[model samples]
Target: MKADFLKYQAQTTPHPLAMEVSYAKGSYIYDINCKKYLDFVAGVSACSLGHQHPKVVNAIKNQLDKYLHVMVYGEYAQKPAVELSKLLASHLPAPLDTTYLTNSGTEAIDGAIKLAKRVTGRSEIIAANKAYHGNTIGALSIMGFEERKQAFRPLMPDVRFIEFNHELDINQITTKTAGVVLETIQGGAGFIEPQDNYLKKVKERCDNVGALLILDEIQPGIGRTGKLFGFENYNCVPHVVVTGKGLGGGMPIGAFTASYEHMITLSDEPKLGHITTFGGHPVIAAAALATLKEITESNLIQETLEKEQLIRKHLKHPLITEIRGKGLMLAAMTPSADITNQIVLQGQEAGLILFWLLYEPKAVRITPPLTISNEEILEGCDILMSVLNKIQPTN
Candidate 1:
């Protein structure tokens, strides 16, 4: 299987982790050799309820018994999709009642950008530097990091960038801007959270300029940040909210929400401006609904803070320079990129899952499942500490 994977699969990186998984259940993944590895990254923060959560699994099974994709999104009123959208609306703030489902987070980001332009009748988009919204062409155009996106030149035009958490950069948002898209908690950029009311200030600027504010909560939303949405923590309500990642538990989904007045515009002027073949597939929607219900109804959301504290307490070491971020969305920074790489590579052998932030080489991602137990948190931290100690320099 490994040989076939290498031969047939098109990979993004020269070398992938390439773990051969036999099965996964609740904060642990089992290799085909039957070795159990504690999952700290939670499939890169996509599996909200860990692996194969009971509620999500049962929901998918129930939905499967009924049907799969009935029709393109927004055409059919599927029960799972309708209930999921309604639940999301109830949880989110006003003017964010209507939802446009998509196949993945990047699609949702693209849709949100489109909605902003359609609503504002502007072409320019202001995005924060180091923000990782998604990988599609529209998303790639606004990506702040030039090294990763330079090769794909001539992307969508008129996309500008501003330094995140920098108050002075708010001036970049003007009336000509269609929207200002930002990660509620900047993911790939070392789990950086909004500080000094940065998001609120940006929203205010967008309002002053009549531009829309789009918050990309793909990594920090879905109860991972001690709240259903990361913007809530910062007291910033965006004109549009884009979410994905853990929204589907272990399944795949993404959605953008806005007011009915703004969302309905996409329907008439274009008479189907944006269409998806399986945006709200019944099975995936069922899993997402179940995941959202479980997270909101259970103590998982609040436990994220407790678990984050436990991780910080256990992961303290000379090699760990600082822990950035809040709740389950965290990044442990090391003194050097080599040390960070060593910890992640050696961690797999140590039976613990660890990952790296997209653009921050010295930052180790630690976004585990919200349902991860305190004991499990300590156990993973211990493994990380052990790895760091072995790699630490002796003066």
Candidate 2:
């Protein structure tokens, strides 16, 4: 099977951590050998309610019995899509009422960029340094790093770059700019949060320049950061918000939301300006709706902070320099890429699932499920501590 996987699969990286899975429940995943591994990365922050959550699974099963993709996104009055959009609007601040659903976060990002251009009638989109929105051409155009995107040459034009949390860099945004795309907490840049009202200042600058602020909450949203949206914690409401990842509860989905007045413009002048066949697929929508309801209704949201504290308490080591980010969206920084790599590889052997961030080589990704128990948190931490100790035998 491993040989077949390597030969058949077109992998993104040269070496992929191909874990042959049997099934997963709650916070643990089992391999074909029946070895259970405690999940810490939460499927790269996608499985919010953990793997095969009862509600999400039931939602999918129920929707399957009813219907699949009946029509295109906006034409059909689908229950799951409509309910999900309405619920999202209810949670978000005013003017961000309407939503356009897509298959993935990257598509949603491109949608947001189009919406920004439509609303403002401008061409320039500004993004921060070391930012990772998505891999689509439009999203990639605004990506901060050059190494990953250079191969996909001639991306969307007129995209600019700014330093994350650098107040002086805010000057780059001007009246000519259509939108300023930012990760609420810069994920690939080692989970760096906006410091000293950095996001607020950016919003203010955008407001003054008549440019839209598009917050990519794909990673930090969905109750992972103790808020439905990470921007809520920082007291800045964006003109547009893009979300995915944990929203699907192990399913695949993405959405870009803005005001009805702004979103309506896409339908007339160009008439069917942006359309997707499977964007709001009812089965996936059902899963997303269920996931959102469970997140908002449960005590899981508040418990993120407590769980974060527990992780911070137990996972300390001399080799570990700093833990960046809030709630469960954390990055434990080691001294070098070699140490970080060793920890991730050894962690799997020790019955714990760990991973790494994209651009940041020295940081180990540790985004666990919101439903992960306190005991599980401690258990994972102990496994991690043991791994770190072995790596630091001299100390």
Candidate 3:
């Protein structure tokens, strides 16, 4: 299986962890050798309730028994999708009631950008520096890092970059701007949280300019950050909220939400403005519905902060310079990129799972499942500390 994976499967990077997975449950994954590796990076923050969560699994099974893909998105009222959207509306702020589901975070982000342009009739978009929305062309166009995108030029035009959490840059959002897109917590850029009401100020600026603010909650949504959404931590509501990652438990799903008035703009003038055949996939929607219900109904969301504190307390080591982020979404920065790489590889070998952020080379990602227990946290941290001690610093 490992040989076939390397030969047949497409590679993201030459150095894939290449761990042969037999099965996974809760905060642990078992390899073919039956080695249990404690998962700390929950599938890059996708597995909210960990692997094969009962609620999510049962929801999919229940939906499968009924039907699947009866029609395209929004044409017919599917129960799972309908209920999921309505549930989202109830949880979200006013004017963010309507939702447009997609296959992934990138597609949802593309829809949000299109909606912003269609509603406001503006082409100019402002995104944050080092901010990552998605990998799609429309999303890549708005991405802050130019080096990675330089090869893929002629992206969506009129996309400008601004510094994240910089209130002074709010003045750049003029009436000409259709939307200002930003991750509620910049994920690829080392999980940087908004500082001192920065998001609120940006919201005010967008309000003044009649520009829409699109908050990318892809990584921080779905109760990853103690709240149902990361934007809730900051006292600002965005014009459009893009969500995915853990929204579907372990299933793939994404959604962009707006109010009835704002969402309606995507219809009419250009009929079928935004359409996706598999956007609101019934099975995925069922999983998402169950995931949302689980997060909201259980004490999981509230307990995230306590779990975060536990990880932080146990993960402390002289090698770990600092910890950044809130709730379960955290990054442990080591002395150097070399040291970070060593720790990640060593931890994996030592029956622990660790991963890296998209952009921050020196930071080790620690976004575990929201369902991870206190014992699991301690266990993973022990492996990490052991790895840290094994690798001495050159400095």
Candidate 4:
């Protein structure tokens, strides 16, 4: 299987963590050799309820028995999709009642950009530096990192970037701007949270210029961040909220929500302006609905903050320079990129799962499942501390 994976499958990076998984359960994955490894990354924050959650699995099974993809999104009113969207609307603030489901977070980002332009009739989109929306052409266009996107040049035009959390940069979001796309908490950029009312001020600027504010909550949404959404923690309500990642539990799904007035524009003028073949696939939607219900009904959302405190309290070490981010969405920074790499690589050998941020080499991502218990959090942190201690600098 490993040999076939290397030969048949296309590789994203030169070095990929090729762990042959036999099965996974709550907070743990077992390799083909039957070695149990503690999962701290939670499939990069996609497995909200951990692996093979009962509710999500049962929802998928029930939906499969009923139906699958009956039609393209927004064509047929599927129960799972309808209930999911309605539940999302109930939780979200005003003017964010309508949702358009997509296959992945990147698609939702693209859709949100289109909606912003359509609603405001403006072309320019202002994004924050070090922001990562997704990998699609439209999403790549708004990406702030140049090194990764330079090869995919000549992307969508009228996209500009500004330094995140920079007060002066708010001036750039003028009347000509259709929208300002930002990660509620910058994921790839070391989980940088908006500080000093930065997001609120940016929303205010967008309001002043009549430009829409689109918050990408792909990584920080779905109760991973104490609040249901990261923007809620900062008291910044965006014009459009883009969600994905843990929205579907262990399944795949994405969505963008806005006011009925703004979302309805996607229809009529273009009549299926943005169409998806399986955006709201019944099985995936069922899983998402189940995940949403579990998160909202259970104490998982509130416990995230308590779990985060436990992680911080146990993870204190000389090698760990600082911990960034809130709730379960966290990044443990090391003194050097070399140390970060060592910890992640050696962590797998130590029977614990760890990952790195996309752009921040010095930061080790620790975005575990929100349902991870205090004992699990301490266990993972102990493994991390052990790894860091063994690899401590001799200088």
Q: lDDT of each model, Cα atoms only?
A: 0.92, 0.94, 0.93, 0.93
Per-candidate TM vs. native?
0.99, 0.99, 0.99, 0.99
Residue-by-residue lDDT tens digits, candidate 1, 261-379: 99998997888888899999999999999999999999999999988898888888999999999999999998888888889999999999999999999999999998898888888
Q: Tell me, what's the RMSD of every candidate?
A: 1.0, 1.2, 0.9, 0.9
Question: Clash pairs of candidate 2?
Answer: none
Residue pairs clashing in model 4 are: none
Q: Residue-wise lDDT of candidate 4 within 1-395, one digit each (tens)? A: 98888889999998889999999999999999999999999999999999999999999998888887778788888999999999999999998999999999999999999999999999999998888999999999999999999998889999999999999989999989999999999999999989999999999999999999999999999999899999999989999999999999988899999999999999978899989999999999999999999999999999999998999899999988899999999999988888998999999999999999999999999988888888888888888888988996633
Evaluate residue 284 in candidate 2 and report its C-alpha lDDT on the 0 to 100 scale. Answer: 93
Of candidate 1, the 10-residue stretch with the lowest lDDT total is 386-395
Point out the worst 10-residue segment of candidate 2 by lDDT. 386-395
Q: Give the candidates in order of lDDT, highest first.
A: 2, 4, 3, 1
Please provide, for model 3 over 1-395, each residue's C-alpha lDDT reduced to its tens digit, 9 standing for 90 to 100: 98999999999888899999999988889999999999998999999999999889999999999999989888999999999999999999887899999999999999999999998999999999998988899999988888889999989989888899777888889999999999999999998999999999999999998999999999999999989999999999999999999998988999999989989988888889999999999999999999999999999999999999998888889889899999999999988988999998999899988988888998999999999999888888888888998997776
Q: Pick the candidate with the highest lDDT.
A: 2
Query: Model 4 segments beyond 4 Å from truth?
Result: 392-395
Which pairs, if any, clash in model 3? 95-259
